[model samples]
Target chain A: MGDTFRDEELLADVICRLIGDVRHVAVGAQSPIPATAALLAQARGGGSPYVSLLGSRAHTFFTDGARELFDCAGQGRVDVFFLSGGQIDSEGNINLVSVGDYAHPKARFPGSFGSAYLYYVVPKVILFRTEHSRRTLVPKVDFVSAPGGSPGNVYRSGGPIGLVTNRCLFDFDRARRRFRLASVHPGHGVAEVIDNTGFDFDRPTHVPVTPAPSAETLALLRTTVAPMLAEVYPEFVKRVFNVPAPSP
Target chain B: MPLIAQSLDEALAPIAGGRLLAVPRESSGVAMAATRALIRRGIKRLHLVTLPTSSLQADLLIGAGCIETLETSAVSLGEFGPAPRFVAAILSGAIKMRDATCPALHAQLQAAEKGVPFMPLRGLLGSDVLAHRPDWKTIDNPFGNNDPIVLLPALTPDVALFHAPMADRAGNVFIGTQRELVVMAHAAQRTIVTVEKIHDGDLLRDPRLAAGTLAGFYVEAIAVSPRGAWPLPLPDHYGIDAAHMAEYARLAATPEGFAQYLDRYVYEKRAA
Candidate 1:
């Protein structure tokens, strides 16, 4: 929001809408935004039945005895899963592990956690990326950690369904399992979205601009949440949000 | 006690036979030393919990084939013998991956630690991946009459092991981050702990640092080795020895190789 609703509002709106009436979600390691979103949802009265968290980094608050966020994938217990990727294939598969080979590679990307089991097991796979660049939206993934569409003309389920980037939000056609253009965040256009993706897909008449964040939501997030996180992870305040550390 | 050798072979003398060993990735002194012992003992199956430093050590073990990795997500792919590091060596069929934030996973693990069966999540339905996965079966909602419900199976582990920055001789562990470690301890049947230095009243001083998910009775054994969890955890008293880790990673390739490496380092090099 350049001048409109604040960034926090936007985040809150996206999450509130995403977690509608579903129960049980499986989350992985290296997840901060998703965790924040889920915690925010619970804080805001959208109570989820259970949660499953991944990632092995142990901290007092980060790793304190949390488990059973979901049943298995199908039980409707685990519906929402969040992850980020270094590369995304046209078919919606993500690659975070490596670039060229296993032993030695050009650049070593983060590997997929539960991408094999949970991606195959969980119900809904939601992807979040910071920026939508061609480097990110690729024609083909260097490695297919999780298969999206089967070979030619094969029907499939349980693959990536949605991708939410800083620029736009997209959903795939269940049949062909190809990305069909959806809404682009406000002030952004279909052109910007297209320029970011590596491959071509069906074009919508016009992509809707994402709604601006509300004012009330912004105050709570900035006044409360940001301050708390900053106290613990000052670096997060500086890097991820690009804001200077406030008085703590 | 056969001279009470400090070698892993001698230290890990008590536990009965179980293939899969689960532990957190953080650099807890006890688990770290025990993992070192396990590596030295040639324990084959290893399931790791999330720790900031576990990924690096997990890679070292994977490269060595000392443990068959149960779960893995690559953060940075480094070089291994001919193969690239962080590659998903196990290429199974694809599944619908639930995208969760790090914090969310922590909460879920908490729920598991508490022994509650399931929790409901909002906002992930209608995802392409969620619609897939073989285990998920659809059933018509009895109340709604037509709408379908997505059902999931339960996931449980054999063991949960973790490292604590500090612990007592009686096995009270202390931690800084209240991550999902408590949940992991509760979720598993038996837990093994390793610590950096055992003090008399540290955990009791700050009970908040302990994962109350399970009482002290749940812990099977506690090992107190300073700098036990290196790299992942650089306890205030100690720091990570990068050269030692690099050499250790290189040497810990096989049971025989580890034995030879141990003979040089743990066995003949130093007397416990």
Candidate 2:
């Protein structure tokens, strides 16, 4: 890989493509990649689909406070949203509550922030976890903050459509209740993903390498997305793009 | 007589010890200066609720031994990193943690606002969050056929304490789109506010600001404390003091360091 862009930029490009032509995209807390993709989509899509980034002073349209995000998703207005877990099972169960037991045992992660609701309401809930290992991607999550799929009678309009990890992308099949290997990132192979992933997933005989970021996408990301992201994630912008945040 | 308190101490006087106090999210005006004041007072055994999530305020209170029980969805330092004191307390079983999902807290608060017994919410049906929460009950939807859903009991806090951009002489606060604060104020028995400044006229008189105004009827007391949400961003007003927060996250990582932090920044006032 040349010094053109980092792995995060490539991942953002894939996410931008996956976001394709959506009316509205919402990026949650602690997600710089998804936020980049959402902004990239907006810049490329001629601002057709709006992007609402949580914790940004200028980007968000909510006048009602934090709960408005929940209210909008509940009303089915939010088209795409991003979520990740400390532990994600093959079944798509996300555990952000804790790593061990409910009462108390081991690790304690940030509690679920609207995942239980957003997973059910948003049309496309993309699961993005940068770390793709057996420890992070387990056979079963110790605590399920939100289940991947629900019973037939359950009124769920949205759920995990795809899982984007450092190694590969896995498309979730709601009916099958399992993830199918979509594509592997560049320089990484099936064997690496297989070695790292704890849970079982279906894959084709020949898996393709995840596409690199296009020249145009890279340009927009560096010129437009980087500056926009500086407000919310200054450290990420500095580390990835080597761009200093604009002075307030 | 005006409801404005002469000093911060008088404003926070109603918060007596061991009461359920509701607060807003971290990004949405967090009342950090007020939190420092509470720490200075050495208030104890308070049940604190961070509407959906919190950052510095929770960490500071927990570090200072002010909070007995913390009811919130998540507590993180945002860009700084995981809340060290919060992590330490949870792991050591130092605080009573009522872990909950974000919407559940909002729904429960909404229930209290509506004076309803409970609110039925989607999700959490097969979740461990539901399993651990004995207060949350799953019942078959009376209207639907064999559809099971979880009902969250109303959590009516005793006091709603938060900071805002501005308040009027009438004591109406302008929260401007942070609707959960409205719900919190309506649900809690008493509402206390610390604002960056107080507007001259009645906030309700201006139609543009009226929708965002919380009437004086709901507000019990008000204190003017500029930069009240320092170290945390007050939406649409100022960005976060990242350096301060980073310093906090660094110093508060250890118990002794946290004590030193309290001594330097919290307990010991700088000479003017």
Best by DockQ: 2
Model 2 C-alpha lDDT per residue in residues A1-248, reported as the tens digit of each score: 34476889989988888887778899998899999999899889887688899888767877776778888888999999999999999899999888776667588887888887789889899999999999999999998888999888787889999999888999999999899999999889999999999999999999998888878788889998899999999888988999986553
> How much is the lDDT of residue A51 in candidate 1?
47
Maximum-lDDT candidate: 2
User: Model 1 compared with the native: what TM-score?
Assistant: 0.57
DockQ of each: 0.14, 0.68
**Which DockQ value does candidate 1 get?**
0.14
Quote each prediction's TM-score. Answer: 0.57, 0.97
* Candidate 2 interface RMSD to the true structure: 1.6
- Tens-digit per-residue lDDT, B1-272, candidate 2: 23787777789888878999999887778888778888888899999998989888899999899889999888998778899898888888889998788889999999999999999988777777777789999889999997888899999999999989999888989998788889999989999999999899889998899998888889999999888888777877888887788899999999999999999887786211
Judge the docking of candidate 1 as incorrect, acceptable, medium or high.
Answer: incorrect
**Local lDDT at A40 for model 1:** 54
lDDT, each prediction: 0.51, 0.88
Model 1, span B152-248: residue lDDT tens: 3333456666666665655655655433455566666656665566666645555464543234555655555555565443433443443554565
